[model samples]
Target: MTATPAIEGWFTTGDQPALIGERCTTCATSYFPPTAAAAGFCRNPRCEGTEFEQVELSRRGTVWSYTDTRYQPPPPYSAPEPFAPFGLAAVELPEGIVVLGQVAAGYGPDDLRVGMHVELVVEPEHTGEALIWRWKPLAEGSAA
Candidate 1:
């Protein structure tokens, strides 16, 4: 079966992947997990912007905070039997926004720390039939 993005248009896939966001045409504010609309007004309280453009966010970011998911999520989520806990993180990308997502497989809270660099990666969801974005911690001494 072909792997497909569980949530289409939220991100790109390949060697270098990035989250797709919307940039306000007038104020230039960026939003991740982008809006469902093709175009709309900006949300900035001080900016009266009325248009937005699609933009790809930085592939790398710093871990602002993180935690473990102790309980299995409820439906329509299909949790595995004897549910396995996973790490979730709120990463702050270079664009000055915080985006939350799951940590890459084989990694957990023990593998993360505040201010550590991470790269965007795509992985199959529980069913292994769809893809989703996850954060992978950058190795120490390696370029982010």
Candidate 2:
């Protein structure tokens, strides 16, 4: 099946994957799911600069936290029949940002540990089959 991003411009898929974000030219603050940096000033209260640059976020990070979803979500989100629990993780990247995403296949909360290394991967979205970012645990002895 052909795959497309549920939300365009959020990320790109290939041999390497990275999230797209916007960085403020003045304060170095960044925003994910890239916004209209040209339309407004930086998010920092102390900086009033209006220019921003698009940047690719780090692909590797450490698992900051994780959890399991035993229940399905509300509308706009359609779970498969006889839904099974899945895992979620909050990863802290070298960029000083923490991002939340679903765990990759075969992974659950039990498979995660705080400070464990992880890397970004693209997988099909549960509800729409669109490409989305997921966190996969890095194999021991492997470098991200």
Candidate 3:
């Protein structure tokens, strides 16, 4: 059987890539992947907000945390046989939100830092099925 495609329509602007999330019109809190359920309320109790509007996130953020997967992930995540380890990271957006995604291939943990600026990138699926999100170092001297 072929693999299922991941969520669609979740893309940053092609020219200047940035994570896209939804902002609560009432409370002003933002969320990634644009929450679909009513449970998308802002965490701030004082606001008790609803109504999210699509918002483009800041292009750059510091590395908040990270890890590497040494083993192959089960079914839903397709990987070639004799799977190689991949890097996973939690990047802190300028909006104060942390987003989790894969680190761009060719970079390793040694290349990362807790406060290094990184930009979002959409990579082709090696397995030929889904689109994957990854983070890469912003070009030197370029504002993210």
Candidate 4:
């Protein structure tokens, strides 16, 4: 079975995966999930820019916080039977925005700490039916 993104238009699946976001043309602020305002404008209150440019957010970031999900999430999320705990992290990127995602396979909340560097990775989800983005902790002394 071919792997496909769990959610489209969020992140790229490639040799180097990155989150897709939008940069306001006027204030130079960026937004994840590429915010689409009904009025079609920048989200910044100080900037009235109506145009935006697509940007790929930093591939690597430092963990701002983390947690272990011990309970199966409610639907539309399809957790596996006999749900297992998984690590999740909020990573702060160079863009000054925080992105949340699951921790990469083989690593758990025990492996995470605030300020730990991590990289974005696209991998098969718990159900193995779709692809999703996860945070892979950087090995010690690995160049950022």
Candidate 5:
């Protein structure tokens, strides 16, 4: 069976993967997991526009904050067997939003720091029914 996103429409899966967000045509505000239906209205109190466009978000961002998961998460979350700790990061993209995601395998809290540059990557989940976005720390010498 082919893998898919656990929840559809959150991101793109291909040679160049990106988180999909919506940009308000009127006020230029953006939203992730994009607003739909009547919720599609501009979030900005000043703008009344109801039009929004899909946009591919930046693949790189700085680590705004992060943490380690030492224990198995509750139901609906597919935790790895034996439950090794994993890192989670809240990265601030150039678009001015902070998106949270799991850090790439082989990484943990010890390997991360505030403001560290990171890039997006896609990996299969434990169950294999989904492919998920992960964040990888960029090389120290590389500029984001």
Candidate 6:
């Protein structure tokens, strides 16, 4: 797909795509790609008995780490011939969870930083079957 397709009922505003996740009721921990059921346990031992509740994630976060994929990824990830490198970043959300995703098209290491703020976005993969989550640098004057 030339543009990302929304996963129905996942994001708050379908047009502004986001990753799906869940929050633990007991310890307030969050998970990416939401757990399969509501009765999931928290990773933290003190809150192991908590149940996860589906929730929309914050659109903004600070970069926690980053890396690049210089070679073609195995099946499942589609890349055109002469495969160019793609960036990956781990972002720390407001609720204290870190989410990893690819960087949005046109962004490179020069435009990223460990503590820099970024906003979550979705981009359609070249294969046209799924929407991939990505991150973009937050606008200079925008609040994180």
Clashing pairs in 2: none
Candidate 4 residue spans exceeding 4 A from truth: 37-39
lDDT of each: 0.89, 0.86, 0.74, 0.89, 0.86, 0.76
Q: How do these models rank on TM-score, best leading? A: 1, 4, 5, 2, 3, 6
* Candidate 4 lDDT over residue span 2-81, tens digit each: 88998898889989998999998889988887874434998788988988888899999999999999898999888878
Query: RMSD per prediction, one decimal?
Result: 1.5, 1.8, 3.1, 1.4, 1.5, 2.8
Please provide, for model 2 over 12-111, each residue's C-alpha lDDT reduced to its tens digit, 9 standing for 90 to 100: 8888988998898888887776874856877678889799889999899998999999898879777788888899999988877789999998889999
Taking all chains together, the TM-score of candidate 2 against the true structure is 0.91
TM-score of 1: 0.94
lDDT of model 5 at residue 42?
A: 79
Per-residue alpha-carbon lDDT of candidate 5 for residues 1-144, written as tens digits (9 for 90 to 100): 999986688898988889999888888877776764259577778889899888999989999999998789999777878887889999999988899999987888889999889998888877788999999999997655
The residue-by-residue lDDT of candidate 1 on 1-144, one tens digit each, is: 989998999999988988999888788889887882344567778888877888999999999999999998999988778899999999998888999999999899999999899999999988899999999999886555
Model 3: which ten-residue window has the lowest total lDDT? 1-10
| Stretches of model 1 off by over 4 angstroms after superposition | 36-39
Q: TM per model?
A: 0.94, 0.91, 0.83, 0.94, 0.92, 0.82
What's the lDDT of the predicted structure labeled candidate 6?
A: 0.76
